[model samples]
Structures are given as structure tokens and as C-alpha cells.
Target: MQYGFLYQFFFYLFGVIGVASAITFVTRKNPVAAALWLVNTMFCLAALYIMMDAQFVGAVQVLVYAGAIMVVFLFVVMLLNLGQPSAAADIKGTGARIAAGVAGLVLVAELLVLARQKLPPLLPDLPRGTNITVPITEPLFRQYLLPFELTSILLLVAIVGAVVLAKRRG
Candidate 1:
């Protein structure tokens, strides 16, 4: 029927898939399976971005996160020959699990408080045909240039480090 209705439907569906994928990513014993789950999660997020009308962000999410980042993850998994299932003994203990659960609850509470305080009310009707490209891009390149470059460099370094760690020592 309406575009907004379709968008909302897909949004909820993808959101559920994203959460499921994230859980699978964490719980899967196989490295490849975890990476695959992560990739699925990224794709769902990209779909959500598209539903929000952030075309540039959606494309970047798919291209950079789902495509490039997942490729790197898969490469590392393959290079390390992480084919075997993780040993059952490597799982965390009950005390660590309790601590992690408590930490997660605290984080959720903090996020809820922050969201309640900072989020503006959604406008009933956003201005039609509004263009945000220049507004968004100009500041990203001009004001945040250094931080952006640094982030890219940091990611590159992480990739290199992963490669080095996975390589066989001569």
C-alpha cells in the first residue's frame, strides 16, 4: 500500500533479523559461521539505513561494512584456518556470565536514560523534497576530516595486525 507502511514493515523485520544475527555471531562455535552471521547482521543494518532514507549511509553500510569489512573478516578466518569448532572448555564461567549480564543491564539502563533526555520529538511531517546531501557531506569532510582520516588509518592498522597475527612464523 503506502511507502511508509512498507518501510515500517521491513524495518521491523530487518531489525529482528539483525538482532538474531548478532546473537548467532556471538554464540556460534565456528569462526566462519560467526563471520557469516556478522555479515547478515550488517546487511540488515544497511537495509534499515535505506528504509530511513539515508541513501549514502545505506550504500556505505553495504559496500564498506557488509562487503569490505566482512571480506576482511572472512580472509582472517580463512588465513588462520579456523575451521574446527571451538573447544567447549573455552567457554566463560558462570561468574563471568553473571558479570556480563549485569554490565549489559547497566548499559541498557544508561542508554534508555540518555535516549529519553536527548532525543527530539519526531516531526509529524518532514519538509517534502528536502535535500540533505550538501548539509551532511560538507561538515563530514570539512569539520570532521582529521578524525575521519584517523579512523581509516586505525582500521587499516587493525587489518594489518590481524594479518600479521594469522601468518605462520618462519
Candidate 2:
């Protein structure tokens, strides 16, 4: 009841922050600044995942996306010397400004719609002293093991590709 309400409130709070941060990330002209804003967005998303009771996913979101991936992005930005400040001539014209305003209004309307909705319960109540990790791990290892290993392999390939590209550019 009360707990659920609090959870919903925080969920919306984090959701809004995540949306705003994502907008900031894309709007920034400086690549480093944009990457930092993206990291903020990732953190907000991780908070949302935790609020939804997916603790393992949330932790991975922060550790993998915000930590590891962000470091890689920042490193690449530095390696490419992309830290130079954006030119002042990049300002938007009147039509672009109006479009941004309309997009903002759309976001507000969506938020209002979310406010009126109640999320269905995620799980039946767990018994006292139940370990949360057990539920998450059992299914991940037994049912989803192949996909998990494939994802790891994919990530490794991406990292190797990045290294090769960087070397070519250097």
C-alpha cells in the first residue's frame, strides 16, 4: 500500500531524470560532456531497474554500462581528441526551438498518463528471509545459460573490434 506508493513515486522520479539526462546527452555538442550525461542516464535507468525489484539487472546496469562502457567511451573520446569545446554557431533556429518545446510537452503528457496508472504486482510475497539472488540465478543459469554466454562472446568481439579500429585510426 504505502510502500507501493513510495516505490511508484521514486520510479517516476528516476524515470524523469533518466529521460532528461538522455535528452541532455544527445543535445550536447562536446562528445565528452555528452558521454558523461549518458552515464547519468545509465545510473537513472539502473535506479529504475532496482525499483522494479530486478536488483541483479540494476547492479549490472551500473557496473557494466555506467562503469565499464562509460570508461571505454571516455577513453575513445580522449584518444580521438574530441574534448574540444563546441562552436557557438551551433545554436538552433526558431523552428528547432519550437520542435523542442513540443517534444517537452509530449513528455509531460506521458508523465501524467503514467501517474494515473498503477503497476501490477511483480511477484507474490516472498517468505521471510528468502534470498533474492536465488530466484534470479537459478533461471539465469539453468534456462538462459546459452544466451548469457553468447552475450559475453558478443561483448568480447565488440571490445576487440574497438581496439582494432583505434589502432587503424592511430
Candidate 3:
């Protein structure tokens, strides 16, 4: 389907905002601030996903990642008293800084290569009026059922562990 200028405009707008928010997330010194920025980035990504015709995935992204995961992260941060100045250490020293710079350069190179790829659209080439979630939910529940259950169990374990650790330390 032929898209108009507005489609492209919103796509690029969300894309740029996503990238900028992700950078802000990384550069933040406070873990809570960083997580909030990360949530903003996730929202931008969800918008992009919706724009690309993946409504279910976008909704899941917002609900699961931004809502659930970030809430867990912030809860853990608060439980562990991470608001203290000494809770995190800066990446000091010339060697560590140089290593970080090299890693950043490698990431930039990978992104450049990814940008050159002519990838297909995420959704299938079905009629625009078709229900998209039916195709996705089938395999997600059938083929990937085990992994999905395992992921939930893992998250439960993580939460329990965090609580146990916090209680012990307190």
C-alpha cells in the first residue's frame, strides 16, 4: 500500500524520539530516572510498532515492558535503597573509558550495517482489513507455550529473590 507523507513523518518522528530517549536512559546517573527514560523509549517504540501495523505487539510492549517490567525495576530499586549517592559507581579510569568508547563504536558500526538491510515489513502481506492478532496468538500460545510459562515462572522467582535479598539486608 502506498503511504502518504504523514505516515513517513510520524515514523521518523517516533524513530528519532525513541533513539534520543534511549540515549538519555543510558546517560542518566539515577537508576530510577534511567528506568523512566527507558519507559519513554519503550512507549516510542510501541508507537512505531503500531504505525507499522503491529497493534497487538505494540500494546503488549507498553503493557508488559513499560508497565510491568519498569514497575518491578523501580520497586526493586526502592527496596534496595538505590537512591543513595554511593549506590552506583561512575565508569572511571582511562582503561574502562577507552573500552566503553570502543564498545560504543562497535555498536554504531552494527547499527550502520543494520540500516543498510532491505528488510521486509514485519506483518504479512494480508489485506489491510484482516485481523493481525489471530496469526500471532496462535503460535504464541501453541508453539511457544512452554517458554512463555517458563518466563512467567522466572519473573516470579526474580521477584522473590529480590524480596529475600532486601529483607536479609534490611
lDDT of 3 by residue, 114-152 (tens): 999998866555576889898788998999999999999
As a whole number from 0 to 100, the lDDT of residue 26 in candidate 1 is 89
Which residue pairs come into collision in candidate 1? none
Using lDDT as the measure, which candidate wins?
A: 3
Name the 10 consecutive residues with the lowest summed lDDT in model 3.
Answer: 83-92
What's each prediction's TM-score?
A: 0.75, 0.71, 0.77
Q: List per-candidate RMSD values in Å.
A: 3.9, 3.8, 3.2
Where model 1 places Cα greater than 4 Å from the true spot, the runs are: 1-3, 107-118, 123-133, 149-170
Worst ten-residue run, lDDT, model 2?
121-130
Tens-digit per-residue lDDT, 1-170, candidate 2: 53678788888899999999998988888888999999999999999887766777889999999999899889988887879866675668999989989998999999999999989965755465777688888988999999999999998999899778767653
By lDDT, highest first, what's the ranking?
3, 2, 1
Error of 2 at 115 (Å): 11
**Segments in model 2 whose C-alpha atoms lie over 4 Å from true places:** 1-4, 86-121, 125-128, 168-170
Candidate that beats the other on lDDT, 2 or 3, i.e. the better one: 3
Best by TM-score: 3
Q: Could you tell me the C-alpha RMSD of candidate 2 in Å?
A: 3.8
Identify the runs in model 3 with alpha carbons over 4 angstroms from their true place. Answer: 84-89, 115-129, 152-156, 159-164
